[model samples]
Target: MGIKGLTKLIGDNAPRAINTNEIHSLFGRKIAIDASMCIYQLLVAVRVGADNLTNDEGEVTSHLNGLFYRTIRLLEIGIKPVYVFDGAPPTMKSGELTKRAEAKKAAEEAAKKAREEGDLEMAEKFSRRVNRVTPAMIDSCKRLVRAMGVPAVEAPCEAEAQCAELVKNGDLFATASEDMDSLTFGTSRLIRYLWAGTASTASKKGIKPTEFALDVVLQDLDLTLPQFIDLCILCGCDYVDGIKGVGVVKALNLIRKHGDLQKVVDTLKKEKSYTVPDPYPVEVLRQMFVEPIVTPAKDVVLKWKRPDVNAIKKLMIEENQFDSAKIENGIKRLLAAKQKTSQVRVDSFFKRATAPNEAERAAKRKAVAETNKKSKKSKTQKSSTSTKGRAAKAKKDVT
Candidate 1:
């Protein structure tokens, strides 16, 4: 909200916005990913291209193919991605999921109805195209991810929120998610376009060469971490649907002046007779954004531990009928790359581990110090200018 220009750049080309050179700097970075989010994206892509993806056994291979290729790419890039999967849907989000399920059910029913009306081909196509996230499917994917040596965490609630909490606490350098709500959730680093390949180049203008620090954002918005949450609510985040007639620009302006949600709500209510709709219950939003379930802290071990080539080959080539030559080449290339660049030093991965809560507090203190310094300098300059202006006025009066 503080920078409309940056948001526009992101929208223009999310993948191309990130510079590859910057990625090298993050070679050893611990990236916490919302596993469900990534899997959902893959699922959608695969479902759309279902006709083209099949194994020798004539079984659909879209999910497995996407997982293998993407995981390989991430490992090749030297990113230590810890994937957090959703354990169970949050109580508040049940309505959203139920709504989706109802939509899918209606679609299926319509397809069936169409079949009865003699539209058999269309019905068959629609039946094959429905995307569902089942418990069994989630478990299967988790096993695959673990097999690939990516640490997988099962989050009790919102996976993205838990990942954000990890980033906030410095256990993770950034939370990789498409949602900008991570910023409001108080992640020190929220990286979009993480899996975009060359598409990250598009984010070059929006993001600085170095990671965009949370302190920089807070200063730019003239708000605290909590106030930033309020601003996001104003901008229509999930916790609270944004206020009517408030866009990004308007939301930023309101929050910068008021510095809190209640004040902003009161100001708008007085000015526009806006009976502020409670976006969600205040408690719910607070809990969702301010407090997230964090996994126990542990020392990060960053290494390009080789994949089990024999197992991968067995799964992809022997069972799935993947091109044996291609699988062999990919494995060979991965091993060679690992050998060429074996050691990586992650800045945040230290010998000692700190509790997630302690790390967050430390981050907050550092942010506050930087903010205070900036504010003090601004105040000093203003006061100095005021004194000079008064002295000049007195001299003019004496003359």
Candidate 2:
């Protein structure tokens, strides 16, 4: 849903954009989490044979279960999490939202067909695709997050954009989300796999938890902030439809060569046959990403209070029907984590996570690159031999 193929584009063009950091290294950092994204993840994770975890009366409670434990886990490790919820979809993003709704409908039908055919596995697969983070789910997640002492903030616009605003205001260090939208929204540091030791939406694709610094990405790709936003739009974003055939690489090249969207459109007109959107809404889409409407930096208040043990218990055990002992155990963990981070000797709770080691990380990256290079070379040699053998056989046939 983020700028399509933006991750791949960054990997290919801006290697310096990425920095590998372990979950343990983030022991005491304040991270702004995309709450709705995590709820969608739980819908996929805490399921019973493709169906969600539900309380009595057929109400979905997987999100509650997931947030309760995951929030505990974050606190246990010394990370101060501020869960940010999406406010309203921008007018420009209505089209993308509509497309997602239709896709969910199609997935629902496909899931039904799979179930009728006795393909439980396929049914579950399609069902996961169909599952959405409903309004009820969002409210429940916020309730659980706040009960755990984490601040739950509802953004005036996109959650990622608000998280970016928080980071810029120095209220938080980074935005932790599965999608590259945080970077597009101008988050200074975008951390994928915040829960990688547990999971991100990226965990489904086996993506490693990595960090992307916007400044580094811009410097490495030689792109201005505006140019980066334009490139994202050309590649397709949630706000506007992209050109039919212009992919990430093409978008990057166009932005690099022409300087802006107007010039890119003019050149595409003269140069080649490319299908641009009819009502491109270039300025509208660009502004949406470039200068998103977020709650004013000062107006947003983030406070991590003491975990309300009784409030958490009432929701998890009474309302949601979670195991009483398990809910209590999680609370104990939250308390223990506050006193002292589980695996580290930290003097303070709020600033517990340790910074990453640059030297060791760079060395490990070099070794990985070398190993991959060797593996690729080996495959190419084997492919060359196979081709030669096929050619020799073809010659003998001719003879």
Candidate 3:
């Protein structure tokens, strides 16, 4: 279930719902973060009461501020975060993208018309809004993240799926995302309420927030990982959008009875007499869920580098016109956490270095570099071969 549904079900009692003590027991664990998801939350939250946040030179500072603060919080919690950014979205998501573009275009036009009609206030309000995710903006965020010592993964398509795969393979403990879709996507651990403790909330005795554990979900559904994927398809997901009239409850029941999707489909056709036009081409969804790209060399590390306090103060207090005190406090908290984490990492590194000899270390380094070189060469060769094949096919078509 998504956050909306889960929140509704638990209400104020949500916090008491999950064993946070046990969850924190898994602290210092590596988390594969859906970077775009966190970015979206930052954008929306920061822009809630304003159209745009401008820096001293009148540049947009909303995205930057959001990225800066949230990243600090994640690091403060002692969680090693591997940020995964979206690349070109998969082909099936084109329709959703097109709809988003149209909506943005319509809003822009309305804003323009409001300005022409002398409705300055409305025009200004609409003009300050933004939702489109651009390649350039994503690149800028990636650069900032890298400079901060956060390792980033460039996912070919769905970042959440790749993150989920990382967790499944035990490379990561969990995938951190606000979107509950990660559960359906096959992540073993999906922790919601990541920002729970730091933020304010109304007290409701006996109510607890919950982190929907995958094992519990799987046991409840009585389905294996692949079977759960089948169930999600029934419940409607990005690949299928959804089946008409089939919701979470009904989808669960359908899957439980049929044992698998094909049988479920056959039963629907025969018993219900419903012609289910292939919900989505199964092959496409399979390709979409292909194994994530994993780095063979785990040299990549996440460390908390100290924030440039003067730079942050200038950006937040002077430029953005935020309260100086709040900005200072936030920076102080961030710096303290950074110092602690850095010391731990440094100590661990030196300890490991002391254990290995110079010759052994050199040999290990050489082997890794050669392996990476071979991988790159093979990828280039494959790309060249594919291009030649396409050219040959075009020539034959011309004939």
What TM-score fits each model? 0.68, 0.83, 0.66
Q: Write the per-residue lDDT of candidate 2 for residues 68-144, one digit (tens) a residue.
A: 77777777767888999999888878888899999999999999999999999999999998887888888878887
Task: Residues 95-198, candidate 1: write the lDDT tens digits.
Answer: 55666678878877877787889887777566654566567557656666665556777777777777776776667778887666666667776676665541
Cα-based lDDT at residue 264, candidate 2: 90
- Tell me which of candidates 1 and 2 scores higher on lDDT: 2
Model 3, residue 236: what's the lDDT?
55
- The TM-score that candidate 3 achieves is 0.66
Top lDDT model = 2
- Candidate rank order under lDDT: 2, 1, 3
Q: What lDDT would each prediction earn against the true structure?
A: 0.64, 0.82, 0.62
Ten contiguous residues with the weakest lDDT in model 3: 198-207
Candidate achieving the largest TM-score: 2
Q: List the lowest-lDDT window of 10 residues for candidate 2.
A: 352-361
Between candidates 1 and 2, the one scoring higher on TM-score is 2
Candidate 1 off by > 4 Å: 1-22, 46-60, 99-130, 198-212, 266-275, 298-306, 313-321, 345-399
